[model samples]
Target: MTTCGDGRLTCDEETIDTIRERVLSDVSARAPFDAVTGNEDRVSDGAVSGDARATKTDREVAVSVTSLSKRFGDGADAVTAVDDVSFDAETGSIVGLLGPNGAGKTTLIKSVLGMVLPDEGTVEIRGIDVYDRPREAYTHVDAMLEGARNDYWRLTVRENLRYFATISGVDPDSVRDRHDRLLAQLGLAEKADVPVRDLSRGMKQKVSLASVLAGGATVVFLDEPTLGLDIESSRTLQRELRRLVEEEDLTVILSSHDMDVVETVCDRVLIMSAGKIIADDTVDSLLRETGLHCVQITSTDLDAQIVSTLRGQFDTFSANAREAGYQIEVTTDSDGLYALLALLRTSDVTLGRVRTVEPDLEDVFVDLTAGDRTPGER
Candidate 1:
């Protein structure tokens, strides 16, 4: 699916990947961030980690939100977007904020950035209270909000980068070097002279990222940065993001609906719903705690007896039939799929196959936020 707005095209999963392949085949960004094309060596597994280690001493807290709460209207119309949310992101780490639509993810970010003042609570950027010192707080933080409305459509990609770098206070002598480096890194070097209006959505997004980076702020906030990007473009941004965190010692707060990106990029994740922080833990920690417990069984056919047996053994289960066989799903603890296969064999049923299901971040998100009332209700 594709949606067009303000001359920008937002693509869904399949189409986005197809478009990305075409773009990379023609206009490569640069080495580190564009390795998806062919330069695999430049894609470092710990680029962000390396960057973070280099700036460990700079160790200043990047952003902190303590007991923050935001409410709109009153009585029947009341809506709380952030409910006493509090968290601290170190100077050199990538933290992801995740939630379903209307889950208060945007509200929390906006309050922290001083775009909307919370009814109660405080947001501090680099130790500067956003409410008390909005300007001062903003000075230490740079953000690429959804779609990042910063590009000069009339200017060429190169000219726009240079202009933003200059506005960001880059020294005139260093502007060209910085612009060229960014253009090459983001794969816009060849299109340096192409007007922004002519660029694809992914290209425009890269430009947005470059603009925020040019600011040299200690903390960067990216809301849904990969929402409409193809798999490869998303991967490239993740690599460069890690580079920034590991090498530049930059603190990044990313709010996105992309679980794959969150799983691969963030050091920790905060799950939000109904304006509250429901879960916060490292990616590994969440996985470990959740455990790998899924049951899979394939048989020539499933009888009502088997359905009853499965329902008795697990909280939830599903069954479906296809050409190969009938597939059954069940909740299990961290155990191999062999156990279920054994059960089928012992039952004297014609067992077709079995497999274990691995849990991903999306499962974690759905499980964690399942309790909240719909955001629309709030």
Candidate 2:
């Protein structure tokens, strides 16, 4: 037993596991909802089973939120956190949620998870209303929040997996094979018996993720899943997540500040600002729709006069001194590009190299929310 920071006596891991088993058993006896089983069949020999695989052509809605609104405080002091937000996450896909600080992303996520009671709106999981049928609706759901600390420190990696599965109303034994697969995929197999506290921060993050999927949750929420990981470890987790989504019909709602991860992994992105979703579309579509293009030009003949002339003509023009030449970047459309080239020709500027700058998700995010000053829930 250990005394927690709050001065509460906490039972040992064995004792806690026992209590969890009893609670699950009692809940099963009451039959509020059928326990999930046969998850081992979802994967076989390190591959997704044919019967469990989901494709984009036949995807189903995994999560649906409509007109969700939440406000804090009351009267004059009241602040609306989520304002009539609505979206759907499809099965076998990763949806990225993004927002600047105080943009209501956190409030929207909490409301959907039933962690916060919204003043209005509806949340549904797997076609079941979350507020009206939470027990049934949550059977297909799991979440890993706060990154590495989401798992038990005292429990071993495998123990954490089994514990989460058991508490989620699944028989741990029934999914032992699936747990083994998760361990291997996440590179935790060798440390299966090591306590989570004994592992590195990145490894602990992986354990938290494995625990989320241990119970065969079809819809999962991951926040900064690669928070403490190195480049290779982050890539490994990203590949595993995509594989799970494509192979096992998993639906993921991923929230992260890493725009590269969001662009590479998520099939679609929802950007929130001022307590509402301001943008909803695929990364490619969003980029194209921004209607902005950047071009970089390197020239040896770009003197102060030429630079000032270009800057005066193009508001987005920026120039940097380089050993070989002056490198300048300017935002322009096709017509503007032609005009820029013609201006450089008239100035007799000798160009060294020119290339197009690709705009990423972060660029689009900033462009959209650049003018937003409305404060909202963080």
Candidate 3:
């Protein structure tokens, strides 16, 4: 056994795996409400549900943001970074924020993190206003931002965890058992003594994650957790995060451009654009609400008027100019496809190819953010 700085007699990395297995076994046997993850099949193969998790026992509100708004610059130069965004995330659920580059995803998360103050609205942790009660709010929250900046570069993985947990007011001795288990689960047992700066980007990120999970924080904010990792590394980290939420009873808010991570890990999704919340709901519900499936349409001498007519009916209509005419992909279902075909024949256009294709999250994302106005115009 190795002695930690806080005088805890804990088995160091050499024997952590064995201890972790015993700990996890005990932890996993709890009741459904107390199990590693309460939501059934919410995550599969490192992907969130296309439909989102269907059920979970009710839990108290973990984080609440009300009518939050922020702006930069002044007068004509003023640009709203976050526009009246509001949402509530319950304990043990993962909520995601997705949007294009300037869609205020970062600003919204920053406001919640207290990294940037919101010009309007309130942020609360377990109903305590974060802006008004930062010290108290921080006790229940921790975030792993991009770049693993939450961690100290020169500190060893074990050292970082001990430091962060203590500074967050968690007695190291009380959580020493968990601290070892986290190191094991993150695959850092062999390198627990290695300085964080000596590790790979993915390893450093995992170390950062270890810090977050060890704090006993009621809420966790992970900003682009998968940003710089490779495929396998990404998958590994994603799996760990899923387990952390389920087993730890921790609420999570995720911000990512990677829809796969968001869809796989999040119980609910909030889509941002133009400094405002344009969509908020489950991923499956959002896909269903789009009322769309793929139907490809190819034509010879495709009349411009017919394309215009189709556009009026279908929210998504993309046409590729061809030598003879054009090929169009329309987002609709079987019944609508038939109607479109009938309409095309009525217009006397020579159709080439028409068929259905699978739907993708990208499709839904495109549809949700589709608008003609450039960022400057808005």
Number of the predicted model whose lDDT against the real structure is largest: 2
lDDT of 1 by residue, 98-155 (tens): 8877788887888888888788887777667878767656655778886746777656
Compare candidates 1 and 3 on lDDT and give the better one: 3
lDDT of 2 by residue, 234-342 (tens): 8989999998888777899999999999999999999998888999999999999987778899998888788888889874678998775589998765677889999
Clash pairs, candidate 1, are 29-186, 29-187, 48-242, 51-246, 51-247, 52-246
TM-score of each: 0.75, 0.80, 0.71
Please report the candidate that would top TM-score against the real structure.
Answer: 2
The per-prediction tally of clashing pairs is: 6, 0, 7
lDDT of each: 0.71, 0.83, 0.75
Question: After TM-score superposition, what is the CA distance of residue 286 in candidate 1 from its true location, in Å?
Answer: 0.6
lDDT of 3 by residue, 176-267 (tens): 67778888877889999898889988888788888887756668888888877788877877787788778656789888889888888889
Candidate 1 clash total?
Answer: 6
Residue 109, candidate 1: Cα error in Å is: 0.3
